[model samples]
Target: MDRRKFIRNTAATSSLLTLGGLSLNSCDSPRNKHITILHTNDVHSHVDAFPNDHADFPGLGGLARRAGLVHSIRQENPNTLLFDAGDIFQGTPYFNFYGGELEFKLMSMLNYDATTIGNHDFDNGIDGLLAQMPYAKFNFLSANYDFSNTVLDGLTKPYKIYEKDGIKVGVYGLGIQLDGLVTKQLYKETVFINPFEVAIDMETKLKEVEKCDLVICLSHLGYEYNLEQKPDDLKLAKKTKHTDLIIGGHTHTFLDKPTVVTNGAGRDILVNQVGCFGVNLGRIDFYFNNETTVADGYTIKV
Candidate 1:
Protein backbone atom coordinates (compact mmCIF):
# COMPACT_ATOMS: atom_id res chain seq x y z
CA MET A 1 0.00 0.00 0.00
CA ASP A 2 1.31 3.45 -0.88
CA ARG A 3 0.89 6.14 1.77
CA ARG A 4 0.61 8.80 -0.96
CA LYS A 5 -2.56 7.11 -2.23
CA PHE A 6 -4.25 7.70 1.12
CA ILE A 7 -7.37 9.88 1.20
CA ARG A 8 -7.13 13.66 1.58
CA ASN A 9 -9.77 16.39 2.15
CA THR A 10 -9.80 17.95 -1.30
CA ALA A 11 -12.84 17.43 -3.56
CA ALA A 12 -13.21 13.77 -4.63
CA THR A 13 -9.70 12.94 -3.38
CA SER A 14 -9.55 9.12 -3.07
CA SER A 15 -7.02 6.68 -1.64
CA LEU A 16 -7.13 2.93 -2.21
CA LEU A 17 -5.98 0.02 -0.10
CA THR A 18 -6.39 -3.55 -1.29
CA LEU A 19 -8.20 -5.78 1.18
CA GLY A 20 -7.11 -9.44 1.60
CA GLY A 21 -4.08 -8.63 -0.59
CA LEU A 22 -6.29 -8.61 -3.67
CA SER A 23 -5.14 -6.30 -6.43
CA LEU A 24 -7.75 -4.77 -8.71
CA ASN A 25 -5.33 -3.54 -11.35
CA SER A 26 -3.66 -6.94 -11.77
CA CYS A 27 -7.00 -8.82 -11.77
CA ASP A 28 -8.84 -6.81 -14.41
CA SER A 29 -10.63 -8.94 -16.96
CA PRO A 30 -13.33 -8.63 -19.60
CA ARG A 31 -15.70 -10.70 -17.43
CA ASN A 32 -15.29 -8.36 -14.47
CA LYS A 33 -17.79 -5.72 -13.37
CA HIS A 34 -17.20 -3.31 -10.52
CA ILE A 35 -19.71 -2.34 -7.84
CA THR A 36 -19.10 0.92 -5.99
CA ILE A 37 -20.53 1.24 -2.47
CA LEU A 38 -20.73 4.71 -0.92
CA HIS A 39 -21.89 4.99 2.67
CA THR A 40 -22.36 7.35 5.67
CA ASN A 41 -23.40 6.90 9.31
CA ASP A 42 -24.53 9.05 12.25
CA VAL A 43 -25.05 12.14 10.12
CA HIS A 44 -27.29 13.65 12.83
CA SER A 45 -29.00 16.44 10.86
CA HIS A 46 -25.78 18.18 9.81
CA VAL A 47 -27.23 20.00 6.82
CA ASP A 48 -24.51 22.61 6.85
CA ALA A 49 -20.76 22.61 7.47
CA PHE A 50 -19.34 23.43 10.87
CA PRO A 51 -18.45 27.04 11.45
CA ASN A 52 -14.89 27.98 10.36
CA ASP A 53 -14.05 28.90 13.96
CA HIS A 54 -14.94 25.51 15.43
CA ALA A 55 -11.97 24.05 17.26
CA ASP A 56 -11.93 20.41 16.14
CA PHE A 57 -13.77 20.19 12.82
CA PRO A 58 -13.78 23.73 11.54
CA GLY A 59 -15.28 24.19 8.02
CA LEU A 60 -15.97 20.51 7.62
CA GLY A 61 -19.02 18.35 6.73
CA GLY A 62 -22.34 19.36 5.14
CA LEU A 63 -25.07 17.54 3.22
CA ALA A 64 -24.62 19.72 0.13
CA ARG A 65 -20.91 18.91 -0.10
CA ARG A 66 -21.61 15.23 0.47
CA ALA A 67 -24.26 15.29 -2.21
CA GLY A 68 -21.85 16.86 -4.66
CA LEU A 69 -19.20 14.25 -3.92
CA VAL A 70 -21.73 11.40 -4.29
CA HIS A 71 -23.00 12.86 -7.53
CA SER A 72 -19.52 13.07 -8.94
CA ILE A 73 -18.81 9.47 -8.03
CA ARG A 74 -22.10 8.35 -9.56
CA GLN A 75 -21.30 10.18 -12.76
CA GLU A 76 -18.00 8.29 -12.96
CA ASN A 77 -19.58 4.91 -12.20
CA PRO A 78 -23.16 3.94 -12.83
CA ASN A 79 -23.12 0.77 -10.72
CA THR A 80 -22.98 2.74 -7.47
CA LEU A 81 -25.10 2.07 -4.38
CA LEU A 82 -25.36 4.64 -1.55
CA PHE A 83 -26.37 3.62 1.97
CA ASP A 84 -26.60 5.00 5.53
CA ALA A 85 -26.17 2.98 8.71
CA GLY A 86 -28.42 5.08 11.09
CA ASP A 87 -28.95 8.19 13.23
CA ILE A 88 -29.89 10.51 10.38
CA PHE A 89 -31.94 12.58 12.77
CA GLN A 90 -31.10 14.65 15.90
CA GLY A 91 -27.99 16.83 16.74
CA THR A 92 -29.00 20.07 15.05
CA PRO A 93 -31.81 22.61 15.00
CA TYR A 94 -32.88 21.34 11.58
CA PHE A 95 -34.24 18.20 13.15
CA ASN A 96 -35.93 20.11 15.98
CA PHE A 97 -37.55 22.55 13.56
CA TYR A 98 -38.44 20.20 10.70
CA GLY A 99 -38.64 16.84 12.45
CA GLY A 100 -36.22 15.17 9.98
CA GLU A 101 -38.19 16.22 6.89
CA LEU A 102 -35.25 18.19 5.50
CA GLU A 103 -32.85 15.41 6.28
CA PHE A 104 -34.93 12.79 4.50
CA LYS A 105 -35.56 15.06 1.52
CA LEU A 106 -31.85 15.82 1.18
CA MET A 107 -30.91 12.15 1.48
CA SER A 108 -33.52 11.28 -1.11
CA MET A 109 -31.99 13.87 -3.39
CA LEU A 110 -28.66 12.08 -2.89
CA ASN A 111 -30.47 8.90 -4.04
CA TYR A 112 -29.73 6.75 -1.02
CA ASP A 113 -30.34 3.06 -1.68
CA ALA A 114 -31.17 2.06 1.92
CA THR A 115 -30.55 2.74 5.61
CA THR A 116 -31.08 1.15 9.05
CA ILE A 117 -32.81 2.65 12.09
CA GLY A 118 -30.76 3.81 15.09
CA ASN A 119 -31.93 4.42 18.67
CA HIS A 120 -31.70 8.17 18.19
CA ASP A 121 -33.96 7.91 15.16
CA PHE A 122 -36.74 7.36 17.68
CA ASP A 123 -35.85 10.49 19.66
CA ASN A 124 -39.15 12.10 18.74
CA GLY A 125 -40.90 8.73 18.90
CA ILE A 126 -41.76 6.23 16.19
CA ASP A 127 -44.36 8.61 14.86
CA GLY A 128 -41.71 11.20 14.14
CA LEU A 129 -39.74 8.68 12.09
CA LEU A 130 -42.95 7.57 10.42
CA ALA A 131 -43.77 11.17 9.54
CA GLN A 132 -40.52 11.57 7.62
CA MET A 133 -40.82 8.24 5.79
CA PRO A 134 -42.95 9.79 3.08
CA TYR A 135 -40.23 12.33 2.40
CA ALA A 136 -37.69 9.61 1.70
CA LYS A 137 -37.56 7.73 -1.59
CA PHE A 138 -35.29 5.04 -0.19
CA ASN A 139 -36.30 2.05 1.93
CA PHE A 140 -35.44 1.25 5.55
CA LEU A 141 -34.06 -2.20 6.38
CA SER A 142 -34.58 -3.49 9.92
CA ALA A 143 -34.29 -7.28 10.10
CA ASN A 144 -33.98 -7.55 13.88
CA TYR A 145 -36.51 -4.88 14.82
CA ASP A 146 -40.05 -6.25 14.76
CA PHE A 147 -42.64 -3.66 13.89
CA SER A 148 -45.61 -6.01 13.62
CA ASN A 149 -47.80 -4.34 16.27
CA THR A 150 -46.49 -0.83 15.68
CA VAL A 151 -47.37 1.97 13.24
CA LEU A 152 -44.26 1.07 11.17
CA ASP A 153 -45.75 -2.32 10.40
CA GLY A 154 -45.29 -3.14 6.70
CA LEU A 155 -43.40 0.13 6.21
CA THR A 156 -39.91 -1.41 6.46
CA LYS A 157 -38.46 -4.54 4.96
CA PRO A 158 -36.15 -7.06 6.56
CA TYR A 159 -33.87 -7.26 3.55
CA LYS A 160 -33.56 -6.34 -0.09
CA ILE A 161 -31.75 -7.72 -3.15
CA TYR A 162 -30.06 -5.57 -5.76
CA GLU A 163 -28.50 -6.52 -9.09
CA LYS A 164 -25.50 -4.69 -10.50
CA ASP A 165 -24.10 -5.63 -13.89
CA GLY A 166 -25.51 -9.17 -13.52
CA ILE A 167 -24.18 -9.62 -10.01
CA LYS A 168 -26.64 -10.40 -7.21
CA VAL A 169 -26.21 -8.43 -3.96
CA GLY A 170 -28.22 -9.07 -0.81
CA VAL A 171 -28.40 -6.52 2.05
CA TYR A 172 -30.07 -6.55 5.49
CA GLY A 173 -30.29 -4.27 8.52
CA LEU A 174 -29.75 -4.74 12.28
CA GLY A 175 -30.65 -2.41 15.17
CA ILE A 176 -29.43 -2.16 18.75
CA GLN A 177 -31.51 -2.92 21.83
CA LEU A 178 -33.56 0.04 23.04
CA ASP A 179 -34.55 -1.21 26.51
CA GLY A 180 -32.44 1.30 28.47
CA LEU A 181 -31.23 3.44 25.57
CA VAL A 182 -34.63 4.63 24.42
CA THR A 183 -37.78 5.50 26.30
CA LYS A 184 -40.73 3.12 26.26
CA GLN A 185 -42.95 5.82 24.82
CA LEU A 186 -40.65 6.63 21.92
CA TYR A 187 -40.03 3.12 20.59
CA LYS A 188 -43.35 1.74 21.79
CA GLU A 189 -44.06 -1.91 21.04
CA THR A 190 -40.98 -2.30 18.86
CA VAL A 191 -39.75 -5.75 19.73
CA PHE A 192 -35.99 -6.22 19.70
CA ILE A 193 -34.65 -9.49 18.29
CA ASN A 194 -31.14 -10.87 18.69
CA PRO A 195 -28.87 -9.49 15.96
CA PHE A 196 -26.63 -12.57 15.96
CA GLU A 197 -29.63 -14.84 15.43
CA VAL A 198 -30.97 -12.58 12.67
CA ALA A 199 -27.53 -12.54 11.06
CA ILE A 200 -27.49 -16.33 10.86
CA ASP A 201 -30.90 -16.41 9.21
CA MET A 202 -30.12 -13.54 6.84
CA GLU A 203 -26.75 -14.94 5.78
CA THR A 204 -28.12 -18.45 5.19
CA LYS A 205 -31.03 -17.14 3.11
CA LEU A 206 -28.96 -14.65 1.13
CA LYS A 207 -26.10 -16.98 0.26
CA GLU A 208 -27.68 -20.48 0.07
CA VAL A 209 -31.21 -19.56 -0.97
CA GLU A 210 -31.00 -16.24 -2.83
CA LYS A 211 -27.55 -17.18 -4.21
CA CYS A 212 -26.25 -13.65 -4.03
CA ASP A 213 -22.74 -12.89 -5.19
CA LEU A 214 -22.30 -10.44 -2.33
CA VAL A 215 -24.04 -10.26 1.05
CA ILE A 216 -23.78 -7.03 3.09
CA CYS A 217 -25.04 -6.18 6.56
CA LEU A 218 -26.09 -2.59 7.18
CA SER A 219 -25.67 -2.49 10.95
CA HIS A 220 -26.39 0.02 13.70
CA LEU A 221 -24.71 -2.25 16.23
CA GLY A 222 -21.75 0.12 16.75
CA TYR A 223 -18.10 -0.66 15.76
CA GLU A 224 -16.56 -2.27 18.82
CA TYR A 225 -17.21 -2.25 22.56
CA ASN A 226 -14.66 -2.28 25.35
CA LEU A 227 -16.91 -4.66 27.25
CA GLU A 228 -17.04 -8.06 25.57
CA GLN A 229 -20.62 -8.61 26.80
CA LYS A 230 -21.89 -5.96 24.37
CA PRO A 231 -22.27 -7.34 20.85
CA ASP A 232 -20.68 -5.12 18.24
CA ASP A 233 -19.73 -5.38 14.55
CA LEU A 234 -16.53 -7.32 15.30
CA LYS A 235 -18.51 -9.94 17.25
CA LEU A 236 -21.13 -10.09 14.53
CA ALA A 237 -18.47 -10.65 11.87
CA LYS A 238 -16.81 -13.49 13.76
CA LYS A 239 -20.14 -15.17 14.53
CA THR A 240 -21.70 -15.07 11.08
CA LYS A 241 -20.75 -16.85 7.87
CA HIS A 242 -21.43 -15.86 4.25
CA THR A 243 -21.56 -12.14 5.11
CA ASP A 244 -19.04 -10.40 2.86
CA LEU A 245 -19.17 -6.90 4.39
CA ILE A 246 -20.61 -4.92 7.28
CA ILE A 247 -21.25 -1.16 7.22
CA GLY A 248 -21.65 -0.12 10.83
CA GLY A 249 -22.88 2.83 12.89
CA HIS A 250 -23.32 4.02 16.49
CA THR A 251 -20.47 4.90 18.92
CA HIS A 252 -19.27 7.22 16.13
CA THR A 253 -16.14 5.22 15.35
CA PHE A 254 -13.84 6.61 12.70
CA LEU A 255 -12.06 3.71 11.06
CA ASP A 256 -9.11 4.61 8.83
CA LYS A 257 -9.69 1.42 6.87
CA PRO A 258 -11.88 -1.69 6.94
CA THR A 259 -11.29 -4.32 9.62
CA VAL A 260 -11.14 -7.95 8.50
CA VAL A 261 -12.55 -10.56 10.84
CA THR A 262 -12.43 -14.32 10.36
CA ASN A 263 -15.94 -15.79 10.30
CA GLY A 264 -17.18 -19.12 11.61
CA ALA A 265 -16.26 -20.78 8.31
CA GLY A 266 -12.78 -19.20 8.39
CA ARG A 267 -13.74 -16.71 5.72
CA ASP A 268 -12.71 -13.05 5.99
CA ILE A 269 -15.45 -10.46 6.47
CA LEU A 270 -14.81 -6.71 6.18
CA VAL A 271 -16.32 -4.14 8.54
CA ASN A 272 -16.13 -0.36 8.14
CA GLN A 273 -17.49 2.86 9.72
CA VAL A 274 -16.86 6.52 8.81
CA GLY A 275 -17.33 8.51 12.00
CA CYS A 276 -20.30 10.89 12.50
CA PHE A 277 -21.74 14.27 11.42
CA GLY A 278 -21.37 13.40 7.73
CA VAL A 279 -17.71 14.31 8.18
CA ASN A 280 -16.50 11.50 5.95
CA LEU A 281 -17.76 9.16 3.25
CA GLY A 282 -16.88 5.44 3.21
CA ARG A 283 -16.08 3.93 -0.17
CA ILE A 284 -15.59 0.28 -1.05
CA ASP A 285 -15.25 -1.06 -4.56
CA PHE A 286 -15.92 -4.69 -5.38
CA TYR A 287 -14.71 -6.08 -8.64
CA PHE A 288 -15.99 -9.49 -9.68
CA ASN A 289 -14.58 -11.85 -12.29
CA ASN A 290 -16.40 -15.14 -12.69
CA GLU A 291 -17.11 -16.29 -9.10
CA THR A 292 -14.26 -14.36 -7.50
CA THR A 293 -14.62 -10.91 -5.86
CA VAL A 294 -12.05 -8.46 -4.50
CA ALA A 295 -12.55 -5.27 -2.48
CA ASP A 296 -10.75 -1.93 -2.18
CA GLY A 297 -11.70 0.66 0.44
CA TYR A 298 -11.01 4.24 1.58
CA THR A 299 -12.65 7.10 3.50
CA ILE A 300 -13.03 10.61 2.04
CA LYS A 301 -13.41 13.53 4.43
CA VAL A 302 -16.28 15.73 3.23
Candidate 2:
Protein backbone atom coordinates (compact mmCIF):
# COMPACT_ATOMS: atom_id res chain seq x y z
CA MET A 1 0.00 0.00 0.00
CA ASP A 2 1.02 3.61 -0.50
CA ARG A 3 2.08 5.82 2.42
CA ARG A 4 -1.29 7.59 2.41
CA LYS A 5 -3.15 4.29 2.51
CA PHE A 6 -0.93 2.97 5.25
CA ILE A 7 -1.53 6.06 7.37
CA ARG A 8 -5.25 6.11 6.70
CA ASN A 9 -5.54 2.44 7.56
CA THR A 10 -3.79 2.96 10.88
CA ALA A 11 -4.99 6.44 11.88
CA ALA A 12 -8.50 6.93 13.19
CA THR A 13 -8.64 10.70 12.69
CA SER A 14 -6.56 13.76 11.82
CA SER A 15 -6.59 17.57 12.20
CA LEU A 16 -4.88 20.53 10.56
CA LEU A 17 -4.12 23.97 11.99
CA THR A 18 -1.83 26.85 11.02
CA LEU A 19 0.06 28.38 13.88
CA GLY A 20 2.23 31.53 13.85
CA GLY A 21 -0.01 33.05 11.16
CA LEU A 22 1.44 30.94 8.34
CA SER A 23 -0.40 29.15 5.58
CA LEU A 24 -0.21 25.34 5.39
CA ASN A 25 1.15 25.59 1.86
CA SER A 26 4.18 27.40 3.20
CA CYS A 27 5.52 23.99 4.28
CA ASP A 28 6.14 23.20 0.59
CA SER A 29 8.82 25.88 0.38
CA PRO A 30 12.29 24.46 -0.15
CA ARG A 31 13.68 26.82 2.48
CA ASN A 32 11.35 25.54 5.22
CA LYS A 33 12.64 22.78 7.50
CA HIS A 34 10.25 20.15 8.72
CA ILE A 35 10.27 18.06 11.91
CA THR A 36 7.76 15.45 13.04
CA ILE A 37 7.10 14.64 16.68
CA LEU A 38 5.35 11.37 17.55
CA HIS A 39 4.29 10.93 21.17
CA THR A 40 2.45 8.54 23.52
CA ASN A 41 1.29 8.90 27.10
CA ASP A 42 0.01 6.66 29.89
CA VAL A 43 0.76 3.45 28.02
CA HIS A 44 0.83 1.65 31.37
CA SER A 45 2.57 -1.56 30.23
CA HIS A 46 -0.03 -2.63 27.72
CA VAL A 47 2.24 -4.55 25.42
CA ASP A 48 -0.53 -6.33 23.60
CA ALA A 49 -3.72 -5.24 21.90
CA PHE A 50 -7.08 -5.82 23.51
CA PRO A 51 -9.19 -8.79 22.34
CA ASN A 52 -11.73 -8.13 19.61
CA ASP A 53 -14.64 -8.94 21.95
CA HIS A 54 -13.39 -6.67 24.70
CA ALA A 55 -15.34 -3.57 25.51
CA ASP A 56 -14.24 0.00 24.71
CA PHE A 57 -11.06 -0.45 22.61
CA PRO A 58 -11.73 -3.85 21.15
CA GLY A 59 -8.95 -5.07 18.81
CA LEU A 60 -6.97 -1.88 19.40
CA GLY A 61 -3.63 -0.93 21.03
CA GLY A 62 -0.55 -3.12 21.06
CA LEU A 63 3.12 -2.19 21.22
CA ALA A 64 3.80 -4.23 18.07
CA ARG A 65 1.17 -2.32 16.10
CA ARG A 66 2.44 0.97 17.47
CA ALA A 67 5.96 0.01 16.41
CA GLY A 68 4.83 -0.72 12.88
CA LEU A 69 3.03 2.62 12.68
CA VAL A 70 6.07 4.46 14.04
CA HIS A 71 8.37 2.70 11.57
CA SER A 72 6.24 3.88 8.67
CA ILE A 73 6.18 7.47 9.88
CA ARG A 74 9.94 7.46 10.39
CA GLN A 75 10.41 6.20 6.86
CA GLU A 76 8.33 9.09 5.57
CA ASN A 77 10.29 11.66 7.57
CA PRO A 78 13.75 11.00 8.89
CA ASN A 79 13.66 14.19 11.00
CA THR A 80 11.31 12.63 13.49
CA LEU A 81 11.39 12.07 17.25
CA LEU A 82 9.32 9.76 19.43
CA PHE A 83 8.45 10.65 23.02
CA ASP A 84 6.39 9.29 25.90
CA ALA A 85 4.83 11.42 28.63
CA GLY A 86 5.10 8.59 31.22
CA ASP A 87 3.05 6.11 33.27
CA ILE A 88 5.04 3.51 31.38
CA PHE A 89 4.69 0.92 34.09
CA GLN A 90 2.10 -0.87 36.23
CA GLY A 91 -1.06 -1.69 34.32
CA THR A 92 -0.86 -5.22 32.88
CA PRO A 93 0.83 -8.52 33.65
CA TYR A 94 3.93 -7.55 31.70
CA PHE A 95 4.89 -4.99 34.30
CA ASN A 96 3.82 -7.32 37.09
CA PHE A 97 6.01 -10.14 35.82
CA TYR A 98 9.01 -8.25 34.41
CA GLY A 99 8.89 -5.07 36.50
CA GLY A 100 9.22 -2.65 33.54
CA GLU A 101 12.13 -4.36 31.80
CA LEU A 102 10.09 -5.34 28.76
CA GLU A 103 8.56 -1.89 28.42
CA PHE A 104 11.97 -0.18 28.34
CA LYS A 105 13.47 -2.72 25.94
CA LEU A 106 10.56 -2.44 23.51
CA MET A 107 10.46 1.34 23.67
CA SER A 108 14.18 1.36 22.99
CA MET A 109 13.54 -0.74 19.91
CA LEU A 110 11.07 1.92 18.81
CA ASN A 111 13.83 4.51 19.27
CA TYR A 112 12.07 6.75 21.78
CA ASP A 113 14.12 9.90 22.20
CA ALA A 114 12.95 10.62 25.76
CA THR A 115 10.28 10.18 28.42
CA THR A 116 9.27 11.58 31.83
CA ILE A 117 8.61 9.90 35.15
CA GLY A 118 5.07 9.13 36.26
CA ASN A 119 3.58 8.29 39.67
CA HIS A 120 2.88 4.68 38.73
CA ASP A 121 6.42 4.39 37.49
CA PHE A 122 7.39 4.20 41.15
CA ASP A 123 5.01 1.40 41.97
CA ASN A 124 7.92 -0.99 42.28
CA GLY A 125 9.76 1.71 44.29
CA ILE A 126 12.54 4.04 43.26
CA ASP A 127 15.05 1.26 43.48
CA GLY A 128 13.06 -0.88 41.09
CA LEU A 129 12.89 1.99 38.63
CA LEU A 130 16.65 2.51 38.92
CA ALA A 131 17.29 -1.13 38.16
CA GLN A 132 15.36 -0.89 34.90
CA MET A 133 17.19 2.20 33.66
CA PRO A 134 19.88 0.24 31.86
CA TYR A 135 17.26 -1.23 29.56
CA ALA A 136 16.04 2.13 28.32
CA LYS A 137 18.10 3.69 25.55
CA PHE A 138 16.42 7.09 25.84
CA ASN A 139 16.98 9.68 28.53
CA PHE A 140 14.58 10.43 31.34
CA LEU A 141 13.83 14.10 31.95
CA SER A 142 12.04 15.64 34.91
CA ALA A 143 12.77 19.24 35.87
CA ASN A 144 10.56 19.51 38.98
CA TYR A 145 11.22 16.13 40.57
CA ASP A 146 14.50 16.68 42.35
CA PHE A 147 16.30 13.41 42.97
CA SER A 148 19.18 15.07 44.81
CA ASN A 149 18.95 12.93 47.95
CA THR A 150 17.71 9.76 46.23
CA VAL A 151 19.11 6.87 44.23
CA LEU A 152 17.96 8.54 41.00
CA ASP A 153 20.00 11.70 41.60
CA GLY A 154 22.25 11.78 38.55
CA LEU A 155 20.27 9.38 36.40
CA THR A 156 17.83 11.98 35.13
CA LYS A 157 18.34 15.38 33.61
CA PRO A 158 16.27 18.56 33.89
CA TYR A 159 16.09 18.96 30.11
CA LYS A 160 17.75 17.94 26.86
CA ILE A 161 18.36 19.55 23.46
CA TYR A 162 18.26 17.99 20.02
CA GLU A 163 19.14 19.48 16.66
CA LYS A 164 16.91 18.18 13.87
CA ASP A 165 17.84 19.39 10.39
CA GLY A 166 19.69 22.37 11.97
CA ILE A 167 16.69 23.34 14.10
CA LYS A 168 17.32 23.31 17.82
CA VAL A 169 14.57 21.54 19.76
CA GLY A 170 14.75 21.89 23.54
CA VAL A 171 12.70 19.39 25.55
CA TYR A 172 12.04 19.40 29.28
CA GLY A 173 9.84 17.29 31.56
CA LEU A 174 7.43 18.08 34.43
CA GLY A 175 5.80 15.54 36.72
CA ILE A 176 2.77 15.91 38.98
CA GLN A 177 2.95 16.04 42.79
CA LEU A 178 3.29 12.61 44.42
CA ASP A 179 2.28 13.72 47.92
CA GLY A 180 -1.20 12.26 48.07
CA LEU A 181 -1.23 9.99 45.05
CA VAL A 182 1.97 8.11 45.80
CA THR A 183 3.23 6.77 49.08
CA LYS A 184 6.23 8.47 50.66
CA GLN A 185 8.28 5.29 50.73
CA LEU A 186 8.07 4.70 46.98
CA TYR A 187 9.39 8.11 46.06
CA LYS A 188 11.57 8.76 49.09
CA GLU A 189 13.86 11.80 48.89
CA THR A 190 12.42 12.75 45.51
CA VAL A 191 11.41 16.37 46.02
CA PHE A 192 8.44 17.63 44.07
CA ILE A 193 9.01 21.24 43.10
CA ASN A 194 6.24 23.44 41.81
CA PRO A 195 5.74 22.75 38.09
CA PHE A 196 4.87 26.33 37.26
CA GLU A 197 8.07 27.59 38.85
CA VAL A 198 10.17 24.96 37.08
CA ALA A 199 8.51 25.80 33.78
CA ILE A 200 9.58 29.42 34.07
CA ASP A 201 13.19 28.51 34.80
CA MET A 202 13.45 25.78 32.14
CA GLU A 203 11.77 27.72 29.37
CA THR A 204 13.86 30.82 30.00
CA LYS A 205 17.07 28.85 29.93
CA LEU A 206 16.07 26.90 26.82
CA LYS A 207 15.06 29.96 24.81
CA GLU A 208 17.72 32.41 25.98
CA VAL A 209 20.79 30.46 27.03
CA GLU A 210 20.37 27.49 24.71
CA LYS A 211 18.83 29.46 21.85
CA CYS A 212 16.52 26.60 20.94
CA ASP A 213 14.08 27.16 18.09
CA LEU A 214 11.36 24.90 19.49
CA VAL A 215 10.57 24.25 23.16
CA ILE A 216 8.45 21.30 24.29
CA CYS A 217 7.32 20.13 27.71
CA LEU A 218 6.81 16.41 28.33
CA SER A 219 4.40 16.65 31.24
CA HIS A 220 2.96 13.90 33.42
CA LEU A 221 0.54 16.30 35.04
CA GLY A 222 -3.15 15.66 34.43
CA TYR A 223 -4.91 17.64 31.71
CA GLU A 224 -7.16 19.60 34.12
CA TYR A 225 -8.54 19.42 37.59
CA ASN A 226 -11.65 20.94 39.16
CA LEU A 227 -9.70 22.33 42.10
CA GLU A 228 -8.19 25.76 41.57
CA GLN A 229 -5.15 24.81 43.61
CA LYS A 230 -4.26 21.93 41.30
CA PRO A 231 -1.57 22.55 38.67
CA ASP A 232 -2.30 20.92 35.32
CA ASP A 233 -1.22 21.09 31.67
CA LEU A 234 -3.70 23.85 30.81
CA LYS A 235 -2.41 25.91 33.72
CA LEU A 236 1.17 25.25 32.66
CA ALA A 237 0.48 26.44 29.10
CA LYS A 238 -1.05 29.77 30.15
CA LYS A 239 1.51 30.48 32.88
CA THR A 240 4.59 30.06 30.68
CA LYS A 241 5.98 32.17 27.84
CA HIS A 242 8.50 30.26 25.74
CA THR A 243 7.10 26.71 25.79
CA ASP A 244 5.78 25.90 22.31
CA LEU A 245 4.00 22.64 23.06
CA ILE A 246 2.86 20.61 26.09
CA ILE A 247 2.45 16.85 25.63
CA GLY A 248 0.56 15.61 28.67
CA GLY A 249 -0.52 12.48 30.55
CA HIS A 250 -1.65 11.10 33.98
CA THR A 251 -5.34 11.84 33.44
CA HIS A 252 -5.75 9.51 30.42
CA THR A 253 -7.62 12.23 28.52
CA PHE A 254 -8.03 11.58 24.79
CA LEU A 255 -8.03 14.47 22.38
CA ASP A 256 -8.40 14.07 18.61
CA LYS A 257 -6.47 17.30 18.05
CA PRO A 258 -4.16 19.54 19.99
CA THR A 259 -5.75 22.34 22.02
CA VAL A 260 -4.25 25.72 21.16
CA VAL A 261 -3.80 27.95 24.19
CA THR A 262 -2.65 31.55 24.31
CA ASN A 263 0.56 31.83 26.27
CA GLY A 264 1.69 34.63 28.58
CA ALA A 265 3.48 36.29 25.65
CA GLY A 266 0.28 36.06 23.57
CA ARG A 267 1.67 33.22 21.45
CA ASP A 268 -0.01 29.97 20.52
CA ILE A 269 0.89 26.89 22.54
CA LEU A 270 -0.19 23.36 21.63
CA VAL A 271 -1.40 20.95 24.33
CA ASN A 272 -2.17 17.35 23.47
CA GLN A 273 -2.80 13.99 25.14
CA VAL A 274 -3.59 10.55 23.74
CA GLY A 275 -5.59 8.33 26.08
CA CYS A 276 -3.86 5.50 27.91
CA PHE A 277 -2.87 1.90 26.95
CA GLY A 278 -1.12 2.80 23.70
CA VAL A 279 -4.46 3.28 22.01
CA ASN A 280 -3.40 6.32 20.01
CA LEU A 281 -0.26 8.13 18.95
CA GLY A 282 -0.08 11.93 19.01
CA ARG A 283 1.63 13.50 16.02
CA ILE A 284 2.63 17.12 15.47
CA ASP A 285 4.46 18.33 12.37
CA PHE A 286 6.41 21.56 12.62
CA TYR A 287 7.64 23.56 9.66
CA PHE A 288 10.26 26.13 10.51
CA ASN A 289 11.99 28.90 8.64
CA ASN A 290 14.35 31.64 9.80
CA GLU A 291 11.43 33.94 10.55
CA THR A 292 8.50 31.80 11.80
CA THR A 293 7.14 28.34 12.67
CA VAL A 294 3.93 26.60 11.67
CA ALA A 295 2.49 23.35 13.05
CA ASP A 296 -0.20 20.76 12.39
CA GLY A 297 -1.19 18.14 14.97
CA TYR A 298 -3.47 15.10 15.31
CA THR A 299 -3.85 11.67 16.95
CA ILE A 300 -3.54 8.32 15.14
CA LYS A 301 -5.28 5.23 16.44
CA VAL A 302 -2.95 2.33 17.06
The lDDT of each candidate is 0.86, 0.87
CA lDDT, candidate 1, residue 240: 87
Across 1-302, the per-residue lDDT of candidate 1 in tens digits comes to 21112111111232233344421112222456889999999999999999999897899999889989999999988999999999999999999999999999999999999999999999999999999899999989999999999999999999999988877779999999999999999999999999999999998898888888778999999999888888899999999887878999998999877877778866666889999999899998886664345677888988
TM-score of each: 0.91, 0.90
- In the order shown, the candidates' Cα RMSDs to the true structure are 6.4, 6.5
Task: Give lDDT tens digits, candidate 2, residues 100-122.
Answer: 99999999999999999999999
TM-score of 1: 0.91
Q: Who wins the lDDT comparison?
A: 2
Clashing pairs in 1: none
List residue ranges in candidate 2 displaced over 4 A.
Answer: 1-31, 290-292
